[model samples]
Target: MGLLTIVTAAAVAGAGYVRARDAIVQRAQDNAVIETTNRVEQLYPLPARVFDHAALERIAGRVSGREGSAIAYGDGISAGGMDPSVITGELRSLVSSGRVGWQRVSYAGAVWLVVGMQLRITADGSSRSSGVEVYVLRPFTSEIEVVNELARNAWLIGSAVLILALGLAFLAARGVLRPVRELQLAAWQLGQGDLTARVPVRGRDELASVASTFNSTASSLEHHVGELTRMEADARRFVADVSHELRTPLAAMTAVTDVLDAETASLPGVAGQAARLVNRETLNLTRLVNDLIEVTRFDSGTAALALDDVDVAEVVRTCLRMRGFTEVSASLPDGVRARLDPRRLDVIVANLVGNALRHGAPPVSLTLSVAGSVAGSSLEILVADSGPGLPESVLPHVFARFYKADSARGRSEGSGLGLAIAWENARLHGGTLTAANRPGGGALFTLRMPLGGDA
Candidate 1:
């Protein structure tokens, strides 16, 4: 914008300068022509009456004294202060055509206005040339200087106007962009979880309308999010309450199932089979209730880590032994000790091995290693089973609660909460659990726990 203003102002200034120069030169020429014509009229009658060269030179000297001019008589004698050649051919031609004329010419690094007139007299009632030619040379350098000064002033004013316009445009843009910048900042804050973020409203322009709409939308979003958060909290509290409520009765039922398990083998054929079935179902129910309790603890933020320095390989061996997962193979480092929650680690291993045993093929593998540096080291555990690998669509949601890969098999041996509980336990120990397909055609679950004892 500033550049455009400067260019436009320059063009206007140039045009103004040209017009002003032409007017100044024209007015100067007109004044010079008038003065020369008056002098010529005053001397023409004298030259017409006396045709002698010496007398004409005397009269011309009297008429143009000290001025740079030239006079020519009919008999071809001439007198002037200016060079005779300074009277151009064009001017002489116009005078010979019996017309008063003027022209501007440059000579000796100076500008001059030349005016010419031809004198005539009547003889025998016919008009004939007396051949008294008068020409005047007037310096126009001073008038040109005045015009140049005006042009300089025009350019100066144009530059000042351009600068002023640029300043005003910047101020206006700043005023417009300030509110937009504020809106951008507010949007970034909102995206970063600042629900109360809002922009200020200033005026009744379109920008003000945008600000007002932004505030309105922010308020509505904050209200809706608050409601959603409250409802989620209520749902979690309800689940936690129900889990707590069921624990007492579930304990009594667990005691009854234990007694039945002891008597199942001694009972008759049909009765024994029914007893075993009841015992198995009762244990599955107990496991489900226990898993629900653990999930509630995780959700309520009450789950905490109890870190201990333990050999990771020994812990895996002990968990596999307790779970009777004898067919699963283990590849562990000799004495890979880490600062971790031993109980949580046991839970994670049990769930992964149990899931593999129930849903995966035989020949499961557990690999444990120490990873990262001493200052911020980690324990990485990979549990894989030689089963059909997880479907591509189900792999991402493997750790979600109650997600089943084989939805057609609605009644599975273990509760769906196993992997979810394992995932929460891993996170409680400042670790992560990720599931993927192993290259050899199996589901792999990897657990990484920070070994810094910070959990």
Candidate 2:
């Protein structure tokens, strides 16, 4: 708006200045013609009298006032007030043709109007030229000053109009943007988790409509978020309750399965096979139930660490030995100990090694290393296997519960909760467990734990 006002004001001022200057020049030209006509009338009777150079000088003195004058005849020139040479030949030619000749020209750095006219007299009962011509040089200084003053006024008025227009535009912009600013602040609050944030509605404009829409969207979002939270909570509660209820019956089934395992050899072939199958399925059910209970503990925030000061390398070796992962090689260094949760550390190691044995090829390795001082040391356990690395698609969801990479493979032998449980245990101990593809064609699991567990 300001720019448009500026351009408009400039154009108007420029055109007004031009018109005013032209009118002033025209008025000056009209005045100059009238003065020349009056001077020529006064000179009409001079050529009728007998005149000498001295007489012509007197006539020239009467004709020329504060401006300038020149009277030209054969072998004689009378000039005063200004130089007579300023009258050029073009003006003289027009005068010889019996017409008033006038031209505006610059002389001595000032504008002057040179007017020339021929004087005539009645001789031998016929009008004849007297050979004497009158020329007048009138300066246009006063008229130029008037034009300049008009230009100054035009520009001043243009500046005032521009200022007033800019002020009005600023007020209008403020009125439009106030509601936009309110909506911006409200959006920021909503993004920061303040679901109740809202914009105050003002007039019935586009900005007001936008604010109203934002308020409606925010309200709907808050409602949906609340519903999702309750649903998630309800789902967790159901799992916890079901797992809790199944534990009692699962204990009884495990005891019965142990007896059937002892009597399997004495039964017939089909009955013995059936007994073994029942025992195997019972064990699988028990594991699934226990895993669910553990998941519930994690969901309920009941998982905790039992910190103990023990040699990390011995813990790794013991975990491998208990899990019967004898085919796996170990790079455990002795004489290194720290405050840790040995139990959760064993579980983490067991899960990693068990997963490596079940899913990967031979030449598996487990390495334990310790760093920092005893008070603030950290431990890293790297378990790698010589097998095809995890696919890029499967790496991210490796620890997700019951997530199978190949859906058509049906259910895997072990519950899919192993890696998830391992990850939870690591997180519970203020550590991290990560899986990745080894650079040299294998899968690697890295576990990092602060030696001084968060006690």
Candidate 3:
């Protein structure tokens, strides 16, 4: 666009230059013709009466002797190589009615300005046979000089116009591109997970409209995110409060069961059954309360890790012992150290082992290893069960809070919060937890942790 503007200015200046040069040339030519006529009338004064050839010759000789002057009349000055007599006769024939005449002539490939005036030369009061005519000539070089000056002025003006035009174009481009660059930066920030990023609205123009649109979108996105966060927080709080309320009664029931178990031998059948039911429900309620508390901590951004370096193999051994996985085969490498909050680590490992034991065949397996070689090392733990593998539909939501495979299968003895708590613990440690149906008829849960353990 800048180049095009400059070219357009140049074209306009060029046209103006051509017209100015032509006008200069034309004016100079007209002035030269007037000057020639004046010189002729001044040199050859008109007589009151007509004169013969002899009188005309005398007047022509007087005018020709002056510098930068010439004469052409009806006489021959043979030695001067100009026939004054021949030109004098033709001029007399044209000027018989007393009118001025002009003509353009060229010699030596150059144009000349010529003007003729009527001159009657009389020696006495008596009229002669004919009147005299005087002619003047000048080269067109003076007119050419005027045109050249015009051309020079035009060239300078064209250059100045081009420079000014380019400078303006540069400034305009910067103005337009500045807002676009801001929009680009805002878009990049939004893409990189900054939902609050927005462009500033400045003017009531197209760029302002773009900025307004971007700001509106950012506001909407922030509102939606805040709404979702509030909803989640409210749900977590409700669950935590309800679970706390439930735990009070369940604790009371558990105390009553303790008393009943003490008197179990005396009461025998029905008493034993009632105590078992109470004990089972008390355990379930306890698990539910713990899960609710953990979920609340996560929601309120208070979940924290008490990280310490411990051997992964040792942790796995402790977890399997606690969960009673005596028949499970375990593979672990030495020097596989990981930093983890012991309580959260216990929860993660206990859930993995419990889930496997409850659903797996006799040969459940646990594996632990360090992931990287020398510079960096991450702890990777895998628990695979040889149970009937999870279905495709269930695999996606296996770690979701309170998700169950099927209600028709009935609730398992385990709370659904176990895997969800494990997932949150993995994330709290800056680790990842994933589940997949194994190639064989089983399922696998893999947990990977960072090497530094500071996350």
Could you estimate the TM-score for every candidate? 0.84, 0.81, 0.66
Model 2's alpha-carbon lDDT is 0.83
Q: Candidate 3 lDDT, tens digit per residue, 229-293? A: 88987887888788778878877877887787777768779878877777767777777787787
Q: Who wins the TM-score comparison?
A: 1
Residue-level lDDT tens digits of model 1 in 301-412: 8998887888888988999999898998999778788888888889999999999888889889999887886667788999999899889999888899988888776554
Quote model 3's TM-score: 0.66
Task: Order the candidate numbers by lDDT, best to worst.
Answer: 2, 1, 3
C-alpha RMSD by candidate, in order: 3.7, 4.1, 8.1
Best by lDDT: 2
Off by over 4 Å in 2: 45-52, 55-59, 66-76, 85-113, 120-130, 177-197, 255-279, 296-310, 336-340, 370-378, 408-412, 424-432, 449-455
Candidate 2: the clashing residue pairs are: none
Q: Compared with the true structure, what per-residue lDDT tens digits does model 2 show for residues 1-455? A: 66887898789878988988999999898888888778667755555664567766765666666666555443365534557778788887888898888888889898888877777787777887777777777888898889889988988987887788788888987888788888999999999999999999898988888989999999999999999989988999999899889989989988998899999999999999999988988988888888888888898898877778898888888887887888999998898787888887887898888888878888999988876765667788899999898999999999999876666654536788889999999888778889999889889999887877763
Enumerate residue pairs that collide in model 1: none
> What lDDT does each candidate get?
0.82, 0.83, 0.74
